[model samples]
Target chain A: MDYISRYLAWLGDGIRDWLLNADDTGHKFALMLVAIILFVVVMGAVLLAVDRPKRVPRWLVTVGFVGPALLMLTFGLVYPGLRTLWASLFDRRGQNFIGLDNYILAFTQSEFQIVLRNTALWVIVVPIAATLIGLVYAVLVDRTRFERVAKTLVFLPMAISMVGASIIWKFVYDYRAVLRNSEGDLIAQQIGLINQLLVWAGLEPQQFLLNTPFNTFFLIAVMVWIQAGFAMTVLSAAIKAIPDDIVEAATLDGLSGAKMFRYITIPSVRPALVVVVTTIAMGTLKVFDIVRTMTGGNFQTSVVANEFYRQSFVQQNAGLGAALAVILFVLVIPLVIYNIRQLRISEEIR
Target chain B: MTTTPPPVPALVTGGVGDDDAGTQSSRRGLGLDQRAAKAKKRLTSPWASLLAAVIAILWTIPTFGLLITSIRPQSDINRTGWWTFFTNPTVTGANYQEAMFGSQTNLAVYFVNSIVITLPSVVIPITLALLAAYAFAWIEFKGRNVLFVAVFALQVVPIQVTLIPLLTQYVTWGLAGSFWTVWLSHSIFALPLAIFLLHNFMKDIPPSLIEAARVDGAGHVKIFFQVLLPLLVPAIASFAIFQFLWVWNDLLVALTFAGGTRNVAPLTVRVAELSGTRGADWHLLSAGAFISMIVPVVVFLALQRYFVRGLLAGSVKG
Candidate 1:
């Protein structure tokens, strides 16, 4: 017993040190490679050891294959999830029982109400705007020269991290105060793209991220920029999936240009449009990184997921944070249902 | 459907050309001449073509500005916008140098942390999900459908709801802030979607293949590694690319489990912190953000086809 305890203590120390001293890149790289290989090998070995040529026990095979995943999910996700739900009913300190008070505050309080409003605006605007842009772009570049290059330029943002994307847009929305030269003539040149255009058009540069209400839309623009690619890709495939003969018949029936797009193209890709909108809406609901990286949810820009992080980690209000997360969970339920329903409808139509 | 390739390529190019011939023929100028005159007549409506070009320019210009900024002198970045470089061209590697090895913003360490966190996180989850997906797809077990439904439903549980309790448990187990904690947490969060996606792909494979292996006296493990694994390459590639990008780019998970500690915190957390504390330091922010985004950007551009396949499979009926 003493030996085992000592060995465990030593093992714990080793791991703690390794995790804490993450600067030695070479050592850490080698260690990580070893750890991954060890995990794969151990799992692989157990599976191979259990298999028999002549006869295999069904339960044994199942246990050997699926057991680790089930165990991890139950412990890491399921139980922790239930615990958080329970914790949401407790007070800030998790000591006193305060059933539904946090949830009530989430809906009633001024700050959280703003969070909800921002989330609603995000969900409503981002999907529509992104899908519209995506659909338009996809249709435009369908068979044009350099189609791949055009699509790739739009889709490139999807590859960037939200943090990366926010910086990119933040640069684009950058503002500088107007200044005057020695002759007292104004020489204010806008730095950001949109602001520069505004300057050239004789309009005042706007504070894209700081102004109230409009700021949320500005932030949503970043999301739209990133997600437009996804919507375009999926919808493009759906457009391609429309049988050639159906389109051929439409063309013969005098469907062309606006007539074709409205009558045939739009109807054909309705399911994809639904999928793109809802998928993006679901993603928009949980948009935390952009808010965090750009304004840290300041100036009435906080969404539920970002609010959850601030409350739990920064503010130490566990109850409210849990409730915010629960609200996010509740909000997604409907989108999921709607998405599934549309997919089913699309399947049935086929 | 079984004997022939999909009719998409021909139909896409041909139908698209025929449908747009009317509107595009009228646009005589505006670079329409670059296209072979025959192809120009078959292009999109002039308005649409113009709109696409505008959107594409708008999308690419931001990153282009930042890319220019990342390579510019710090004084130049602060004094003028990236656009000004066209008139007065100047460049430097100082910001990248400072963001990586400089004080308080040594992103090189965090970049390593990202690598460490992403590799095992991707490998472990994909391996485990493949095993579970194989069982869910092939192995006839009691309550398989119910179990899968449960797993599928769990995908809706946002990572936020799981963070506090998971952190509490990690603290109790003395694994908080460790790479082990992150690896385990990421793998757990990824299992539901990974299994669901892989199961879909696995189901598309004919039962005869598995049965053929079974008849040849191959056990489940043998068939999984030898037979099913090979045919599932595209599907595996699709999910693997998504998982790679997801893990590498994740913020909330890393911040929750590994915040405030430089050793375990990935590049996103560090870049986010930099953006907040140094909001006006566009030089460092541009350089750091690009540094963080470099890996995924390269991976995405290189394997774009698989990435698109994943996107379609994720949203479309594919």
Candidate 2:
């Protein structure tokens, strides 16, 4: 027994070291290969064991497959969630029980107030802007020659990480407060696209990411840029699925262009529109990456999600972070409920 | 919340009266003058075409600029706009080489870490969720609907809410700051949605098949493996791609669990840190951004139908 425990711990340490401490990438990858193989074998063994016993009880077989997922969700999600909620009630170190102080601070404090404001701005602006752009594009390119290629251009960003998009847009917004030459001609060029366009228009290149309040909108543009593709793709399908008969009838009603779009097409895709708006809203609410990568949540561009990370991980302020996280969860509930309600309503209409 | 936005302009470029069914590439480059005067009439509304073209160009330009910048010489990159490539074109693989293996930023390691972290994160959640999904769909458990809804509701728990407590738990187990922590964290974050999506797919399968198996003395495991698993393949592929893209692109969970440590941190963390710490290095940023984007973009383009199906599944019933 003593040897078994000792051997187990040593094996654990060695595996951990190989996986987490190896200097060479080849070693780490090789170790991952071995570990993944072991994992598959163990899973295969469990299933094989259940398979061999042909007359196993219904409930036992049910539990055999479902139990692992249930246990993981319980330990990984449910317990930690409740713990975080509980921790939100405590003070900075999480030792003292300070009722509502963290929540109050998150709301009333000047800095966190900015976070709430930024988050609100994000939720409001990103969805509407992206959905509008996406819907417009989806409608125009519904069955055009270049429809797939056009839609892919926009939807491509949804697959890319927010980090990548931020870098992409950060370059677009990159501003250098460059000095001028003898004829006031620029000696230093603005490499960023937006700034260069401004420069081309003979307007002074503004620091797009540094100016407060406006910077939030600049950051929001990145999200809109990415999410619009999602809006277009989903909404396009819904438009296509609108039965051909409905379109034929609508066309016979003298609805050809803008009038048809205004009256028929919009109403037809309402469910999809709701889905797009709410999904984008929920996604926007939880967006930390754009803020993190673009500005590090500086210049008052921090939203609740980014603020939560800043408070918890960077500042080590557990209580505030927990409170911020709770606030995020709270904020998301309405969107989810709203989304579910929309889903239900759409189902009824169908 | 329920109100739809105004319908986009109904400028159908191809009119209702027209069927370009026989239209092929032969018509593509033919000018209205060269082909026929009536070719111009094929456009129902030129204004709509113009608007769509403008938006598409606007959308593509940012990435286009970055791609140009990525391949440009470092000195030229800093000196001129990427659009200037049209006039004085310069291309080099130096930025990619430097970003990948340079002492300052060996992004290649983090790219490998991204792959490592993403695969297990994707595989575990889908596997576990399939089991849970099967149970929810088929089993006559006591509180099945309520439990399923509860699991679905868990999706609303912003991952930030779980990070601190989960991190503390990991530290207690001496697993903090490791790939295990990332794998576990992503798997956890992914389960609620994965389960919900798969269950929706599973419930759509006819109960008669399962009933027939049950009548033949087959148990849950046998029914699942022999009958349901085959039908669930497309649904599973749809979700596998969804989870694959989600895990690959995740930043918050990765950052929280992996914490910028070279051995575990994904490309996102490294790229983000570079933007924060060395904001001036557009050369490295462009290459790194492209490196991170290339896989997901290719996956997206190739398997787009499945990806779109998953998106619609979340909204419109498939």
Candidate 3:
């Protein structure tokens, strides 16, 4: 008993020093390695013990397999989710029950009204615009000479983190006020691509991300740029899966050009189109990174996700944040249902 | 069902004069397959090709612009747009050097932190989900379907909904602001999707294979290790790539838990902070952005096939 207690004390000290108090990279790595080993040992023992001479009970084996995941999910996801829902009804300190006051503020407050309005705009615009662009681009480049390269060029943005993509687009939208020399000749050169194009077109350079309502659209452009690739990849596969016989029959019927595309292509890929739209919508609804990185949700551009982060962490209003998060979760439920319905419909059509 | 190799080589190697006659003859007296090919050719009008080219260029230009800015001298980058680099042609590596090793930026440490955070976050979830998925796929238990559907439905609950309470819980457990918290949070959030995807893959494995193994005195563990695991390598690889990229490129989890300190923050968190604070520091931001993007882009390009397979199988948020 003494030896076991001493061993556990030593282990506790090591964990505290190496993991909880991990201050260096070496210590962090060591802690990670130890945690991995501990997990492996525990799991290995469960499997080995169950595999021994006399067979373990079937239920025991099932428990050994499923217990760890269920425990983690319950503790980490299910509990936290329920707790957040409960806390949304309380005050910022989570000590007093406010009884839907947080939800009322979220819906009625002028500031949060804009957040909700902007999120609605994002959910509506991003999916439609991205899907349209993706569909058109997919059709135009369906089997082009450089099909692989063309698809990859668009798809590459999907690989970039929203943070990286935000920085890239923010640079593209960079603005510098025009200046003149003593002689009144224009001296300041435009640095951002869009502003330079504006200057070249004999129009005044605009602050793309500074204007209140329009800035939100510019941010939405970045999302569409990233998601168009996803839409294209999925729809392209759908387009390819359209049987050649159908295409030949359409051709024999003299269905060519826009006529063919409208009559056959769109109808054929409707299921993929629905999936892409809903998927992008769900993704856009929870997008906090782009807004956070580019504008920090300033300029009246805060969506629900960013507002939730701000209210929770930045403003220390846990109740409002939880309400916003709950709102986001509620918003996604419909999209998921619609997506599954469309998937089933398409399967039935097939 | 006829699959003719596209006339790509002919289009490339054939001279303009020969190209027309060759395609024209092939267009004549052909099957519906050949007629469909001709119709596709007709669809690829010059206008269509130009439109495709324009969209491709539009998609490629932003990243290309950033890549150019990352390499240009800081003074030039600040003075003019990346498009202007073609006229001036000045270049430098100072930005990358400063963003990485300089005391102010120190993205190198965060880069290591990303690697550390990603590996365990990827490995642990895959390990746990493998066992859970096996049970879900093969084990006959009461409430199995209900439990599987419950896990699938959990994907709808955005991580945002759970962040606050999870953070509080982490603090209670004395794990806040540590790599362990980040790892555990990511693993937990990833569980639903991982279990669902791996279960799908496991379900595809033939029951006969498992039954044959079980008939030879193999227990569940033996069947799992000796029978199922060998067939699961590809599925595991696909999911690993997916999870690796998701964790590496993630900002929200890292920012919430580990962004408070340089000791544990990943590259995404640091780069995002740089964007906010040093918004005009183009040189550092550009270099930092690329430094963060390089790993995922490389992984994506190399294992694109697996990545796309995973994407198609389940593209839900990680």
| Top candidate, metric DockQ | 1
Candidate 3 chain B: minimum summed lDDT over ten consecutive residues — where?
B1-10
Q: What is candidate 3's lDDT per residue for B260-309, written digit by digit as tens?
A: 68889999999999988898889999999999999989987888777765
For model 2, how does the per-residue alpha-carbon lDDT over A73-123 read when each residue is reduced to its tens digit?
Answer: 888889999999999999889999999999988889898888888888899
**Model 1 lDDT tens row, A286-333:** 999999988899999999999999999989999888888888888988
Tens-digit per-residue lDDT, A1-350, candidate 3: 99999999999988686766666778778877887888789889887876752557777888888989999999988998899999999999889999999999999999989999999999999999999999988888665555667787888888889999999999889998888899965587877899999988888888999998899999999999998987887777677667778888998998988898999999988877888898889899999999999999999999999999999999999988998888888889999888777766665675
Give the C-alpha miss distance for residue B77 in model 2, angstroms.
0.6
- Sorted into a CAPRI-style docking class, model 2 comes out as acceptable
RMSD per candidate (Å) reads 5.5, 5.6, 6.2
Question: What interface RMSD, in Å and to 1 decimal, does model 1 have?
Answer: 5.0
lDDT of 1 at A241: 64
- What does DockQ give for each predicted structure? 0.41, 0.40, 0.38
Name the runs in model 2 displaced over 4 angstroms.
A1-12, A52-55, B1-42, B311-318
lDDT tens digits by residue: candidate 2, B143-239: 6777777777777777777888788998998888877888888788778877877877677788899999989987677888899999999878877
lDDT of 2: 0.80
Which candidate has the top score in lDDT?
A: 3
